[model samples]
Target: MASETIPITVEFTGGLEMLFADQRKHSLSVPAKDERGQAVTVGWLVHYLCVEVMKDPRKEMFVLDGHVRPGILVLINDADWELEGEASYALQARDNILFVSTLHGG
Candidate 1:
């Protein structure tokens, strides 16, 4: 069952990478379905990042109200996530998902 999971690339930038072990890139394998037997989507990835991957306790800085916080942009395979169905996008094998924060702090 573990071998059946899909492998994908995840990247963070614009200071967001600082929260993820200070690494800008990550490789992950996720199950095909959720606990409810539903196909995994970008939304699932968000939750997984917080619960499983996040080393920081400031989850709200990554996700707010169950979704990606505003001012952050998500891209899939170099295309905007909104064009790919946003949170509903079904993750594919070897897909590249990037999270870039637009907020700048001095």
Candidate 2:
């Protein structure tokens, strides 16, 4: 059987959207589980955005060492991602995920 998909909204702000085809928000349907049938987490969503959605080559600006780079804040459903287990948080249908960059070049 085909894997189930969850629909979620992803938003980028504080200039991070430039890397994602200059778009600030994306609505996507992603697999509910990994190949091993484990629930899909925010970690997986990050990778998906980098590889599938982002059109800019500056991936390092959004992620570093396989994780969201420092100075970028992740919010899940209007709350800080830290309060929601960060990258380990399982994605839910209609969830809203936002990434905001805090670094500014002078």
Candidate 3:
């Protein structure tokens, strides 16, 4: 039978870890498909992180208007998310997704 989930590594940096239970790295097995029964994409992962992983209430710091806030860089497997089709990129097993916040409070 096909696996129901896919393994992935998510890293938070540039002070973003504070929003994720103060952890820098997380090893997770996410659903292989979303509620729509489609391949899970980076966008789905983002929502998962916010709802299932993030413990802090300051969600706006990481996401805004249902999307990653500006100044946060998303890297997929060491490459820019933009190069990988941004949020539309389909998640693969063992993929590493990194979120780096470029905005820092003074």
User: Candidate 3 on 1-106: residue-level lDDT in tens?
Assistant: 3559999999999999999988999999999988878999999999999999999999999999999999999999999999999999999999999999999774
In candidate 1, what residue range of length 10 has the lowest lDDT sum? 1-10
TM-scores, all models, native as reference = 0.93, 0.95, 0.95
Leading candidate by lDDT: 3
**RMSD of candidates 1 onward, in order:** 1.5, 1.3, 1.7
**What TM-score does model 3 achieve against the real structure?**
0.95
Candidate 1, 1-106: lDDT as tens digits: 3336889999999889988999999999899878777788999999999899999998889999988999989999999999999999999999999999998474
- Least accurate 10 contiguous residues by lDDT in model 2: 97-106
Clashes of 2: 0
lDDT of 2 at 101: 93
Task: Report lDDT per candidate.
Answer: 0.91, 0.93, 0.95
Candidate that beats the other on lDDT, 1 or 2, i.e. the better one: 2
- TM-score of model 2 vs. true structure: 0.95
User: How many clashes (backbone N, Cα, C below 3 Å) per candidate?
Assistant: 0, 0, 0
Flag regions of model 3 displaced more than 4 Å.
1-3
Give a tens-digit lDDT track for model 2, residues 1-106: 4779999999999989888888899999999997778899999999988898988999999999999999999999999999999999999999999999999553
